[model samples]
Target: MTPFSQNMVSVSLWITVVMLFGSLCDGGKILVVPVEGSHWVNMDILIKALHGQGHSIDVIRTFNSWFVKENSTYYNSITILNTSGMDEEFVEDMLFKMIDYERGKGQMNAIQLYLHVFKAIHKTHEMICQLITNIFESEDILKTLKEKQYDLMLTDPAWGAGILLAHELKLPMVYNVRWTTTGEGHFDIAPSPMSYIPVTGSGNTDKMNFFQRVKNAFSYLLMDIQNSRFNLPLYQSFCDKYFHPRVHYYELLQGADIWLMRVDFVFEFPRPTMPNIIYIGGFQCKPAKALPQDLEDFMQSSGEHGVIIMSLGTFISDLPDDFTAEIAAAFAQLPQKVIWRYTGKRPSTLGNNTLLVDWMPQNDLLGHPKTKAFIAHGGTNGVQEALYHGIPVVGIPFFFDQYDNLLRLQERGGAKILSIATLNKNTLHAAIQEVINEPSYRLSMQRLSHLHRDKPIKPLDSALFWIEFVMRHKGAAHLRTESYKLPWYSYYSVDVAVTLFAVILIFILSIFLAVRYLCVKCCSRKRKTE
Candidate 1:
């Protein structure tokens, strides 16, 4: 063979050998416990990638979660934890009530929202605590867990139970989040600046005016108050029962080795991050696939007008009928074909242009060539998906981080944020038309998508690399920040601030005393001379 051909053959053979060896080395035991069903979707890419790499995967989830489907083939072992008084119907009813409360009667203030969410969190905590109590108080689940000898535990820190469970099992854990949950007692990574990064429900952007910044700061205080008043107490009660006396729930959270934060700068504002916090923002979203036959026919019929997809996510699918009718009326006026995800009663205002379905393949519709705009509830996943597909949005945010996520989109010219309170057929139609007709929104999203896809290693691969990196280094403790060890005062430099204040006080006191002494001496000399 020629010299060049011989070199190419050698390189190809070496690459093949390395690939085979790496696959063998990638095998490890992994356990995933997702408290919320929506989080199951977030873990899709990571779980699939790990499974493909030959890892043994196990999942434990609650029974009758609409968010998490029963797919035995997805994991090696699936454990369905059943809690009394919890069923699909009950969960759905709770969700419907919460949605109605938020979208229909709830106040727009952050304090009100925090209180509302705290009540929900309290109920969820109680249920999860009962489940944990049952598991530990009964059979030898701990014994079985110890015997499994899992290499790593990946958990969604929506609840404190997951972190405690991992610690009790003596396993290094990784926190995966759909949003930034650091300050909420999930993980202690780098703190995002309050001046720029708005708190979860603040509905403010990174660049805030003075009043907005004040509101944002107040939002954090409200969250802290709620967490302390409601969340921490429950977590403490659980920890006191299950773990050691000194095993503070916060300490257990800080023990996590890696954080897979679903953050991408394309949609998220620029913020500081630490070594262990991996940004695998859009990794969970699957690649765009061809639309199913019926859906394809519908989109093809739209032809020149294009299509608009409206999905409010899983939790708040059942909106109030009147509001749905108003939105439907707005869609009816648009020339575009509309695919609305509705699980409730169909609105009478729905027109020939609108197709209401219980579930529409969101990602596929976003990727379709004929798709022009998206009407969303400002969810992190929906916003990210829209940006990934480069589709402009008319965001009608209802609750939680939805408001904040859409604010970022509005700031970036990728979306127009429409408040639910002020929403009407005229307003909704105008917002949609603005985004659809305005080339700026579409152009902005296109740029973001281009930048998001321009990375050398895809986000999914980067996430997998870090997951294995943690495994390879046995928790990768060196990557963690020592800030977790520091107390709150020390972490925020409160102690340093107090020290500086004391030094300034002493200096001022000495200067005042010296000035008084000089004035007294001069007066005494003048009186003696007189």
Candidate 2:
């Protein structure tokens, strides 16, 4: 055989050998407790990927879950009965109230909105606590879960239920985390400086003026207050009731074996982070596939103008009638075709150029060659996907981290942000036009996409490796910091600072008293001489 042909055969044989070895390796059993909505969407992606890797995944969902179905090809699902704390109605109501307030059809100010979001957040956690309570209190459910003998517990710590489950089952915990039970995951585990690392919902960029920094500080304070008021009251007591005295719910979140953060520096401000955080941003994104025949026909018809995609993520579908009309009118004026994921009443102003569907293959549409700018609600998943596809955005953020996600894009010059209160046809149309026409927007996003895609290993592969690493080792405790076990005083060194201050104060006081004593003795001797 020729030398080159022999080498090729050798390489092919090695590849086949590796593939066979990989297939023979047994995958671990993973228990995934995911949050609903966009959170579940990404979690489901991860679950499928894990399943493909030969892992057994058991996902826990409530009976009234809106997104997570009971039946799936990827994983076995465990349904908790009559214990859904939050669902479709809860999120839908919050969206409409905010929408009404923005449209001046309801009573709400910044404070009111802030309060509403926190109270809603707290209630959501409370409901999750109830879910945990139901599980812990139920003998059959808890015992059955214990018997699963899962290798590791993978959960989104935003709800905190999974943390408790992990602890209860004595399983090593890994988090698919961005937000924790209290606030942003980074804030809980990393030394996030408020000066640069803008707090979630602060709407400030990394470069903050004094007032913006003040606002950032206030946002942190608000998070802390909300945590104390809600998280401690609901979770700490539950922990104290079931677990040991010092096992705080928040601490359990910080103590996770690994954190698969859903963002990267390309989409986030550079900040302090921990070793265990594996950034898997845009892991769910992939190249576009062949479109369904009708969608392909529509794409081809758009031709040079390309198409614009609009979606409010999973939580929103309906809008105020006038709001929908304004958006539809704006899309109508565009030269490009519009495909919007809207299930509400079709807007009267919707042009023939626009197509409204119950759902669209969002990642597929974003990755399409003929796609232009994206109109997004600024959810992390959508924003990340848009960035992955090198598409600029016109963002109308609604709640939670949505605005913050868009703010990152806007700061990077890849997106235009519009306030819901100020959004009209003129504004919407102008924003869309600017994003599409301005070459810089696309260029900036392309740069971000390049940076995001430049990684040695794909994000999904990296995530899978880390998750499997945890399972193989039985835990990733070596990578995890022990800082979570430290008390607040010790973590911040407040006690050390106080002790140092006291020592200095005592030394100064002793010196002062000695000087006064010498002065008094000198005066007495001088008086006696006189």
Candidate 3:
């Protein structure tokens, strides 16, 4: 061949290789839809880390303004899709109207009011469902999906709508369980121990007092009844519609390809976990960023004593006045500057040392050098953020998974739990001082923080790796278990075995009785003939 022909051939081969490499690098994009409130913070960290690793990420925030202000700037590469149909202002107005109705003369008792509130919220489920449908059915979302065709989707399992979307998109999906996903017996796919009613605990074990045992039993019974009343019908309907005709609950959980739980193995010990689940705690941690100018100035004014950062989380910002007053009284006595993130109107008699702000950048504030401690509601996200910053916590947990989270922190010696029911000025003051003055608590938190951050690959990298693994494998069918194929009786085993035993016993008894009756009748007939 001629020299000119050989040179041209070599250049063409190189061009083909370059083009293939670029195509491989592009891969596919992922769309993450996070649950409401601080959940987005964790989702944002995942997005940033994934993008840093060269995969495109699009975040569809369902509840936006409640967590972040409208005008906030997002980084250039990350696309923020805001589809929270009802904004914070609208929600606040609705809540105010409800509150006004409750405050009228001859209002009901606390229990009655709670029931009423529950009913009102229950009625809004349809509205929430409609909003979800609107977002899922949006032209923009469909256009983007059709354009890019996401390789996989990641979302919190609590949002059942994600499951529907995953099915619709025909994309591999992973459920992000932020807390315990097991039921009371560790055999069901309920939300979590703390979030579920009829709380399971060591007190119910063989060593408890009679009263304690009774209390635990009653609690469990109540939880069982409540769950049956509220969830059973929905679960049955979902199973009828989506799952095969007769799949057991346990089997349903085991069928999921992967279950990623946001729990540290260091904590949440003694758990009965399945092989498919991966515990990736501290996923919320990101590199320290500087606080906003206004927040910096406020911290600087706190002086040498340092500041106590108190945030009750986004959902419970409109707490009862009694609860707020109790918290205010506790803050009044603290020597350190109190930075309270209060969404409601300012109290009339708050102390001068306490600073009330409508909203503050929590992670940024926690990362601040002068921030001594965190007083939080023990949400998983809050716990993660506080742990990442090596800040000891004074946890005042209210409801849901907060109780378990606080217990885990307490068990790890990183924080102290103060019940909302028993919260008083003295207890609050002591708890704050214990978290701040106790060097052991800070040391323990720092140790865990280092451990949480010590992974060679960041959480986002791990998450993305698994996601790609699913895509490359065309869904990890091997990870899916056969348990979902079993019947309820066979899945539990006890029901079937017990029923069989009872049937056998009854059969033997019936045979024996039949023989005796025949013998007796024959004897009587012979005697009469004689």
Candidate 4:
């Protein structure tokens, strides 16, 4: 071979090697469609971590989404999808009114509460669908997304809009649940055995008595009925118009490549979980950081008594002033200083010991050594943060999963549940005292915190690993369980139960017929002898 030919061959081989190396290093692009309000924490962390790992991320920001306001800057770029007349003030007003009515009127039962929440959510879904449909109709937004060629769609399935969006985009998707379970989704992910695993808002523990188990079963049925009657149809109407005319909404929701459940065994009961359902519970938690100077001064001034941090989270931050007054009165009696996150009128009885801020660094406050206990509204994030920081809680759960969250903490002996509806100065103070004074509460929290942090890999790493695994393997479809594909009866082994029942019946019938035949022959022989 000539010298020139040899040089050309070597250069071509080098070029091929470089191209392959570049392709191997390039992590696929990720698109995050965050859930409405506070649920975005899970997705936000995942997006930031993926970005850190060299994956390009684009976010779809809806006007009404709390996440867009909070974490949109983290992504490489964002596309603003407007939902007209669905602004933050409007949503805040609706939520505050609903929460106040439920708290004050107390006429709404469990079923009524469920129906009210369902209707409120359905209306939100309607608005979201309109926004999503507009995006699909628009050439610019659709063209941009297509150009990005997002490898995965990450969304919270609390709303069906995400499911519809995923289907339209024709991308592999991951469903993130900010809470332990998003109510009716357990059936789609895995068999949520009512024998041990509690349904959302059922309030039954794993060790339920007979009557309790029956009640739990009834609650599950009622939820299913509610979803089918109200929620599913509303979602289906929009999905049909947008995606396909005959789309099965539930099945579309079940098409997730992975489920990132923000839950851990320390807080939740023992139950069957699917392979694709990864528990990334403490992803929202961070190592203790220095508090703001004012916060630090306040904690230092609290001295030996310590400080209790109070917040109702974003959704219920607008508690009625009267309730706030009651809480302030209780705070006045305690030696421990209190910092309350209040967006309402300042409590009339606001004492010198209490400080009210519109917002405070919650997890950071809980991480403080001077922080004795947390008075939270029982949002999962709040409860998880408290548990993660080893701070015992005095939980005043208002609605939804709040009740269940506090119940689990109470079961774990790390918290006390006070009824928000019946909350007064006395009950508030007493519950606070019980939680603060009890050594067991603090001890329980410390133990759980240890378990939460003591993992082979950090939650962020676990999330990134699973995500990159999918990207590397072109959708980790193998990790997904066959449970999602199984029929409802087959998944729960109802068919097997029926088969066993039939066999038992046939065996009993055969024995009865044989005995009858023997008796008849004996009688006939006796008659002949006579």
Q: For this target, which candidate reaches the highest TM-score against the unseen true structure?
A: 2
- lDDT of each prediction vs. the true structure? 0.76, 0.88, 0.64, 0.77
Predicted candidate 1 versus true structure: per-residue lDDT over 392-442, tens digit per residue: 988987655678788888888899988876788999999999999989999
What is the alpha-carbon RMSD of candidate 2 to the true structure? 3.9
Candidates 1 and 2 compared by lDDT, better number:
2
- Model 2 misplaced regions, further than 4 Å: 1-25, 244-246
Q: Clashing residue pairs, candidate 4? A: none
Q: Quote the positional error of residue 24 for candidate 1 in Å.
A: 7.4
What is the per-residue lDDT of model 3 for residues 68-155, given as tens digits with 9 covering 90 to 100?
3333233222223544433455445444444444445225565665465445433333334444465555778566665668877776
lDDT of 4: 0.77
TM-score of 3: 0.72
* Model 1 segments more than 4 A misplaced: 1-24, 77-114, 179-187, 500-530
Q: Per-candidate TM vs. native? A: 0.87, 0.94, 0.72, 0.86
lDDT of 4 by residue, 1-530 (tens): 99977977886665566445533336778877776566765577777777766788877776545545635555754555566424566556555555566576656665565566677666766766676777878888888877877788877887666667778778888777743213635556776777777777778888898888888899888777767786677767776776645777777777687777787888887787778888888888997899999989999999899999999887665666777788889899999999998888888988899999988989899999999999988888889999999999988766677888888888988998887666889999998999888899999999989988876556666676667666666676787766656777997799999999999999999999999999999999999999
RMSD versus native structure for model 1: 4.8
Model 4, residue 134: displacement in angstroms?
2.5
Candidates arranged by TM-score, highest first: 2, 1, 4, 3
Best candidate, lDDT: 2
Please give the ranking of all candidate structures by lDDT, highest first, separated by commas. 2, 4, 1, 3
Model 2 TM-score (2 dp): 0.94
Backbone clashes in candidate 2 total: 0
Candidate 3: lDDT of 41? 62
